[model samples]
Target: MGDMITTSEQQIPLAKRIRAHIELADPITWISPAMICICGALASGTATGFQWWNGAHWGLILLGALMTGPLGTGFSQSINDYYDREIDAINDPTRPIPAGLVSLNGARANWFFLGFATFLVSLIFKDAMITALAVFGIILSVLYSMPPIKFKKNYLLGPPAVGIGYVTVSWMVGHIIFAPITWQSITVAMINGGLTAGMLVLNDIKSVEGDRQHGLKSLAVAIGVQPALLVAYTIINLCEILFLVLAVMWGNYWVAAFIAFAVIAPIYSQIKLYNDASHKNFMRYLIATNPFVALIQIVSAFLVGGYFG
Candidate 1:
């Protein structure tokens, strides 16, 4: 049986191998960071009065989106899967590694390739700040999953690491690609980071069983699920309220009104989840609420770019 399994692993066809590599990258998860990148670019461009129709402006936007979405995020997810293969065996045996679709060596090679590609692409912009941010993102990605500093093992560290990597860095990279970093952009990015951190806490709820089995101290495991849900709800609501305040302060009443209206459903979803606090309910909450979160980020970007610029 062992020999047959090894033989099948070794004989995976080239097309299937390629598909496994893409699965390791988890392209669906790339959309959020990519959309954030687009928001950043749009915000910066609007603020700076950049010619929207100009090819160069669009090119920069495209490059930024590619770097954050595919290369940077791909590296993060691949490394995470490699390190979490054992946990995945419990939580989701069908993942590329545990399912034997991708060999361990293949996963390592994919992450290294994506990380190197991210670095090389960052240099193409010829901006020192961009290069530095790329390097920071790469290091954070490595630390988030790798041993000795596996952030995912600590409830305090894991979610923030993901939030900073996914939201803060992506937003800053997009903004910096077009304009110098500004207080407004940084502030909004951090608020989004807080939002992401909150969402990540909820994300852990779905994997609580595997996480507890593996002794990984995820938020849901560290604290009871109900308490963790409250923490997540608090963090999320606070960030949204802060953003609404900022929109009002920036005199973007349209953005403020939009936030006020959009927050209603998510708040209700949070209440529903708080009542049940089960993994099944959490999944439903995510589906019901995440789109509104994305819309808030998009509108907030416009608010900062239009008013702060």
Candidate 2:
């Protein structure tokens, strides 16, 4: 809404403005809210967790939901790029910072704005656990990006750090909204986080060449490309299957069925590329669609709601 209200004395092309805004928003990469909800649905499906729809009426987990996806993510990414400008310049010259589409100060300003927004929105959670999770998301994001503890560059630690930040905080969404925390929620979130971390490994696999040149030791760099791809695919696919099986066995197969149906095309396409290995670019080109993968997750969560009375 704020971005849409363009002011006068602005001569920049509207297309460029829109495109720049998307870049500003970081425009939903693969790790979007889809997983948050899928993870949410799986968490919510439990007898203890948040029910899809309460018998009373429809309610929303506004706080954890907000902090996990658009708001928390937008701030985290802007700050991440601000700190990693040099590395990104080499690895991603076309990005807003390197291309001069956005300045360091402007990006920093956005980081502050979004961070404050997350904090303000977090009040909606009310519960101490939910509030704490939101705070953790903020801190982990900053810690993941900042120095002296820049976990982003650590091969073993980086992926898990990022994945855990997302999956657990997101699990809280369903937990507080539907029910309290359960072993089921924790297990599902951990497994789901593992899957996301695996997808991230594929991203590093695509960027290994650039990362090595930049002196960054990513998981992909540690394992190398071929092995890394295998590892990445294995984890993501495993997570997919694990959640599906768990849901089905619990008689809430709707979530798994929806997820499988949505991902069949992307998985097939990815497998085709792997068989050839001639189009490595497809790896990067495709990894950005993670948010789309996340969207399927949201659908899966919604489907889980249906299996209930």
Q: Per-residue alpha-carbon lDDT of model 2 for 122-148, expressed as tens digits? A: 676567776676678778889888886
Worst 10 residues of 1 by lDDT: 1-10
1-309: candidate 1 lDDT, tens digit per residue: 021123355698889889989999999989999888877766675637334778988888889889999999999999999999989889999999888888887888999999999999999989999899889999999999998789899999999999999989999989888888788889999999999999999889889999999889998898888899989888887888899999888787777777777677677677888899776777788887788799899888877677444
Best by TM-score: 1
lDDT of 1: 0.86
Q: Rate the local accuracy (lDDT) of all candidates.
A: 0.86, 0.65
**Model 2 regions lying over 4 Å from their true place:** 1-22, 38-42, 45-59, 62-64, 244-272, 275-309
The RMSD of every model to the true structure, in order and in angstroms, is: 2.4, 6.0
| Cα lDDT, model 2, residue 116 | 83
- Residue-level error in angstroms, candidate 1, position 100: 0.3
